[model samples]
Target: MLTEVNLAFNNLQGSIPSSIGHCQNLLAMSLSHNNLSGPIPPQAFELPSLSIFLDLKSNYLTGGLPLTVEKLKNLGAFRVSRNRLSGLLPNNLGSCVRLEALFLEGNLFEGPIPSSLSSLRGLVALDVSDNNLSGEVPEFLVSFGALKYLNLSFNDFEGVIPSEGVFKNKSATFVEGNNNLCGGIPELHLSRCNSKTSSDTSLKLKVAIIVVILGVTLVFSCLLILWFRKKKEQPTTTCAENSILQLSYQSILRATDGFSIQNLLGSGSFGSVYKGILEESGAIIAVKVLNLLNRGASRSFLAECEALRNIRHRNLVKVLTAISGVDYRGNDFKALVYEFMEYGSLEEWLHQSINRNESGIMRNLSFFQRVNVAIDVAYALEYLHHHCETTIIHCDLKPSNILLDQEMVGHISDFGLAKILSSDRLNYSTNQSSSIGLRGTIGYAPPEYAMGSELSTKGDVYSYGILLLEIFTGKRPTDNMFKEGLSIHNFVEAALPEQVIEITDPILLQERARQGTFTEFTLNDKHLQHLNSIFEIGLTCSAESPTERMDMSDVVSKLCSIRVKLLHPTRVYRERQALYIAQSAGIQ
Candidate 1:
């Protein structure tokens, strides 16, 4: 009975039984994606022989990481993300010297990153994002040749993010949001140390000169000062904020042919989005015109403005300008002009009707394309959740909310439900009870929302979990489960306890190469296994309770690992594919 215990992504509750430490023969133990609480038992980390992987991520584990973790020298992988643990990282973590991947993100950990981590020469990936770590990032980490991926965003680290050596030009390092950090790559726009020193000296000299001049006082020429002031009268408007950036309403009407259906690309809860070309620039744009302009929508409108004003990520949709003015119809109107996305929403392409007959095949999403799209959204979320000055929670994250550009690149749009959590101070909404009623679409909302509790990043994780399930199964979360008639969560729960293959998408059984989506033209068992693992991961993410969902950073990493495995056409993948095809065809 003491085999590898991987009870991740289930509805299991309560603290881990301390008896688990007695599983002496256990090779890998993953208790991730559960609502398991209490400090991680010191015994779990002090296991003498368990080695392959130890992942306790996406749980409600609290208390600072047990110092006992340093004893697991043979541990190859360690992840403990999205917990409430705080305090400085244990300097002895480097004792797991052979560790290849280490994740401690989404915690309250503060203090300087231990310089001892530089000794993790074998480390390939490290994420300590969304913490309160301060002080200079150890210089040794930058030059530690083995480190391929590093994320230290959403922290209070001081000093410069050294751009020399391995850290140069690597976007993944993501050392943003540390206001005190300076003098990195030009992209960061941090002040150069030398310029700061020079500016300090210049400021002193200017102050001295001003003091000396003031000491020499001018004898009253009140009439002369009044004449100078009258000569220097200022203009009424600043000529910037009030300046009109959008075309006239008449021009927009002409471009859209009086709001014809032919010009409409899509419609959403707020408004109908139309595609149009600007008459002056001949530039194509997507315009979202407010439909009802209800009083309740005022908050959403302001939220969008705040989100747009602050964000500047490449993967995010850009708002060219917002048009709000009185029209000839006498009703005040408003619309947002955005850079057009030719492809449209991922939801439409995945599930919506395609042609007149309704027989048109769902646009086949390629493996590489899916991975790339996931990466794009992950990067955007990373920017919002970790790189921004305050953490942002994207409360609504359905596929319909994710749009694809002309290049088929994905961007997470619609920030109306975003909530900013500032780090400088703790603040909660007075309208907390009122906000409780604003739960997102039912199945996507986490258990906390269903129970009418305050919102948190965990709620977003729950939504993402459902999204992952939809992406892998090609089925909506509401789809009926066979016989048992349970929903997607129930189906995944029942299937995962048995095996991952039971819940895989049936369409994937076809020769993946024949599908013509992948650059390579083949599918095999290894790919099947990889898909199975990813499905299991999705199940883990969508666990009923928010506390059981994995952090987005860990989700991205696990998905990337599967993606890498898929790219490598091993014999295992081929054999699995052959077996899968044979089994589906009823071959003995």
Candidate 2:
């Protein structure tokens, strides 16, 4: 009756037991990162009920993959990389058309990749690198519209690489170490193919091309030298000044339909955001129009511009352009144009009741979605704190400031209160001071910030921790129940390692109920432990003392580990229990 088995990273030895096929209800199995050797049991692949995954990577398993793998037609993922497996890949693997991921790298797989695999159009990630795979890279892979990660590196592939579909993106495809590969997109930098023709004619054409290139290079070098000499006379310019879009006030006015109320996306202390479309390219965008009448609104605009001038990250909202000019009436006009996020802010999804459809059932974030958003925000903070030219403190980190795109990916926004730390004094910043009263939103700001502490990366971590707890618990930090010295931090801390299920957002619990996995009567220990670990991270991050809080880098790593555990829960309940106990006792 076992549905899942995850023994990864356990240093387990010996070969997989063929008797495992007797578990007819088994839906997922992960024996990766172990010392298991010997042939993968053909019986293991005979189970049609294995739908979720079968990960056997980083093991010493050997022998040919059994053709019986075709029986797992419903399997979502099939990974056997970093093993000693040899022989041609099973030609019948195409039967698993539902596969979203396939990892067969770091093995002895030989021969051309089977043509049957071309039918797996749903594959999101396909890695067949570090092997003896030979022959031309398959052309059919270009038709796999859903494929995002493709690795055919360190193989024997030879021929012109495809230039369409996934190949068009250099970041999405990995074709390095394949010496014979050529003629991919320009960004791949592979050599061009030679045509079958007379050697003399080809040599003459190459010499003529070289002569043209040298002449052009000589002229361009002279021009560049003159330009540099003249450039020294001009003043230096920041990225913000150089990259600002040349949109006039009239163009922005027309784009936002004369600042109509219907186009309004949201409003805040500094300004209002409106949905806009460029008349030239028809690209959708969000326009933040400053309310100059509001106190410090103009300063907020300058502060945001300064903070965004040099920083760029995937999890941080991209500022396409900034506008500062006079309107038709000769009044001050300031706005920031950004790529429109179709899903809106996280605040609407978490607290607003209007997310439901006609069915009236509330639309809530799945447990995994919440965890991913938390990770995304953590990555943003980590970049700001450690990866930037100078450390940046996003004084405000709250749900409302986090925007979601069409893919539900989180992007940190609203950096009007951001401060850049001086390199000599990493913790303190003279850019913004405690004399400006409170820096961030109420309830989300760290306790030390209220006592006039200098802005630091730890303050951002504290806010992120509070945001994480609110994401899981479905309660705002300023909830009425959190009064009389009962804060969201303690409310969650008091329930940790025991009553986590009771405090978790009921919407998540309802999702589990619909999956037939959990109910009030059947409390899954693994599920509870996962929740316990997440809450513990939040608690650790939100610790009152600045020195006691977990750094953003550590938070990101721990959250990613927890995400892996959530995806692959252990098969044996007792094993999970013992692991949790060991973790609790600080043995791991």
Candidate 3:
């Protein structure tokens, strides 16, 4: 205790001793996963020699962040999330320019983000979500071009987000949780700038004038057509049986309890998702409310009800009801109700920082559990591809769309881009330009989809392979390092060839160490072998040619076999893992 201390995940209780300040030469201090209380000592905040990691997460610590944190000039990483801390962030936090990562989310902090944070030139990741912060988001922060991940969601930010420069270049992921935040990022398809803005009014007036001229030009023709069509047409004044009808708006409001932020489970281009209860039957549901007014997004909203009502499947997200009506302000609104998935999406469980620690939940998924999730997804995709009345291709197949039930079973959600294959048609796409132009999200879209070739069930196989990589490696597809050619594929390939220990996620490393799962060999040797097999599956699935990749059925068989052997302590699985490493390295 005098020189160094590393106590984590022991359920130890009580406040940290102020005497911890006396450990002058301490290189690293981890007091995580214990029941600690009280404000962090000011001395720990001002340690000049604390150059390495300082983790104090998952505790009962409270009160404002110590104002002295700016003095830790050499601190590289600082995390104090998932606590009861409150108050504004320190204005002097920018003094630590050497800081690379900062996580201060899941707290009770309030007040505006300080503009001073723009000085963190080397900052790579910044997350300040799940807080009570308010005010306009400062535009200068994105100027830190080195920033790869930025999340300022679940706050009270208001006003039109600045659209020019960095904001324009950022992805849809950069800004999703700010409810009052509208405009700026084009990918979100949020409302345009308010009409009061000069730029907005000018654009609106031009469009309005053009519409009026077109309307007048077609007026006589419209009247003549209407007279002839009236005899054959009937008005659609009555709502359908499954419709929420005029009470649609009220039912949604009641279910979601007025769309409370707590009920917000997730958000995407489609709209925000809220957990709610169907008042009529007292059943819980997940409601996806689309933002239709945004340009180009109106098509999805208009077609969602029609698409969901027509498509039926055991694995697809069940659409319970749909509501269409005009709000009090006469604004048109529509919402879709889905069966509430208690465990949330696979992506949320895998990647979301919410309720996670250094020892993440993904590591807790037993061998069987991991295999089960993969099999569940395979079954769903198999059904989507071959078992449907008309084959449906799920264009986007990322972890976020693969939801989980209370029992941890998997269900595929989000069908906005599904392509229905006609029985007589050999090709899947209806477009003349081929399926490439109709590609879904990047990374998951197959090579043929990029080549403008005819769509096939094999294309979905290619996507499932990429997804298998994500499931195995727990890495996102559009991750930045892959652009520099440091992807799971290259990393795994290189590691196997050299027997290097560079390819595995650090979480897996720590887990194996704690559990003594690699006692048969040195830590590096065991990790090298274990990850090599995982990466092999990823590589095989992500083969450039769709024909070379295994189908969902074969993939399920292989993964389940491996899972069974690993869980049951079969020597064959162990030897296979080692052999995979040796083969990858061309040593055996």
Candidate 4:
């Protein structure tokens, strides 16, 4: 009747016995910090009652990961890190759908991470760092929505580091040591990467030698013909076609009334944002005035202008005009005018900080409001990453960057660190990065940026995940209480489905409780179910491995489905509502 077996730190040696899986009642087993060797037995993962955990870390185990791992459907935690295991991660890991935690760090695992790993819906913590895994990080991790801890550091991961989900929480994740990583949050302090593909020196040398042998005139003619062909194949968008508005400095200044404190909306690293009204037109606008004295302000102004130039989406913040000229004092002045959002940023509604006005009281978002915000953000990102002519990575995605208009419709803003990938690259499974710079805020930037990863669309998905978590929990990733292994991701991941009420914002909890007693029981049930779905989406988007995060396209689809189930309940809920009302009135 033994259900748990603890054999940790016993200095055990030799391979695990094949007959160990015969213990049908064994719910937990530990043989960690030992000197065990050889391949993992197929029966190990097939054990019916190994639902608690199977800790075999800090061992000398070797060989490729066993494909039989799919049998541990009930397993909660699987730790094989700190070992000498080699080969590719088994796609069968997808079958272990109940796995809540996976640790494969410090192994010899190589090649591209399997996309099938996205099936781990309940996964909360994942660490695949210190391995030899190569290729672009998968985007499905963001789909896990339940993930909290992610560590991809010291690996061979290349291309753009994602900025979404757990990537937004710096301390919660570890993505350092891989030099090929680049273009994440500015807080990561990583080096910038060259956006253009680097030409191989050896290839150039070979071409020179061939040109000399083949005759310079003939080679020059061939090169000219190739250039023309490439040019002809390129997609072109005219300035007029883009419909980019051109505004003058005088017009911007007059609109903001000399950039008065009364008109100041918010201030960031680059400049001060002001609410303005055009002189000729009484239309309301939000003007961001760049501080020329600041080192990177000018660059940020240009970056935002470029990112918004050709992109258009209902959920995306619209740029009416960009002004570049000198101020009255002859100082260089640059500004961006955007459609004003009367309800303010999502950050103001979710947190008690930084939305200060004369009332000095903070506001909170309703459950439905938060879901709408998530949907809006997802749609905007999907357009930028998948639907646009040129794929764009919104290197900075946070609640503050998400503005809610008068109708509480969310709009994604702040593209100061956006990276535009070539449209041709989108034809492939994953897009590439051509950017080199520090990106995103400290608490919201992805970890791989510190290690110099490329700017990929998955990065934006990561940020969106963090934003989603913040909206529901009312806690920032950088909150003072979250430290030393405790993070917003872990905190929420620990309290899910049934216990989510424990960590949710008090306002939401109170509202749900109030509504539960009087509202139809099925409606309340559906609300909680909808909430659980959103949590899963947030976890998936914020996963440690970029490949594990869900793509923006998938995110939008999920959010829309949830919205339908919540707002327009099925006939079952309606029938239950009538039944409950009649029963209360003694009319049954």
Best by TM-score: 2
Q: Which structure is stronger by TM-score: 1 or 2? A: 2
**Candidate 2 lDDT, tens digit per residue, 1-588?**
899898886658899999998989988899977778999898999899988778897677889999899999998878897677989998999999988778797677899999999999988778888788999898999999877778887687888798999999887788865767988898987878765434766688899989878799787889899767534432122235525355656777788998899898888767788888889878788888888888666666665666676665668887877877666665777888777888877887787465664566556687778988998899789878865667777778999889998779899987343333333333324434443322788898999877777778888889998999999999999999999999999999988777888888877765446764645533378777877888999998899999999988667656766776776654221223333432333322
Q: Decide which is better by TM-score, 2 or 4.
A: 2
lDDT of each: 0.66, 0.77, 0.63, 0.71
Ranking by TM-score: 2, 1, 4, 3
Q: Candidate order by lDDT, highest to lowest?
A: 2, 4, 1, 3
TM-score, prediction 4: 0.52
What ranges in model 2 sit over 4 Å off?
A: 1-148, 151-162, 165-245, 352-354, 357-361, 415-428, 431-438, 512-523, 569-588
Q: Candidate 3, residues 96-203: lDDT per residue as tens digits?
A: 777766778657789998877877776656677767788988878657665555666657777777766446656413554464688777676555667488577778
RMSD, each candidate, Å?
11.5, 13.0, 21.2, 18.6
Clashes of each: 8, 0, 1, 48
lDDT tens string, model 4, 236-333? 12232344344566666688888899999888766778998887767788987777787656555555566567666667777777766556665666
Q: List the residue pairs that clash in candidate 3.
A: 497-585
Off by over 4 Å in 4: 1-246, 354-357, 360-362, 415-438, 511-523, 570-588
C-alpha RMSD (angstroms) for model 3: 21.2
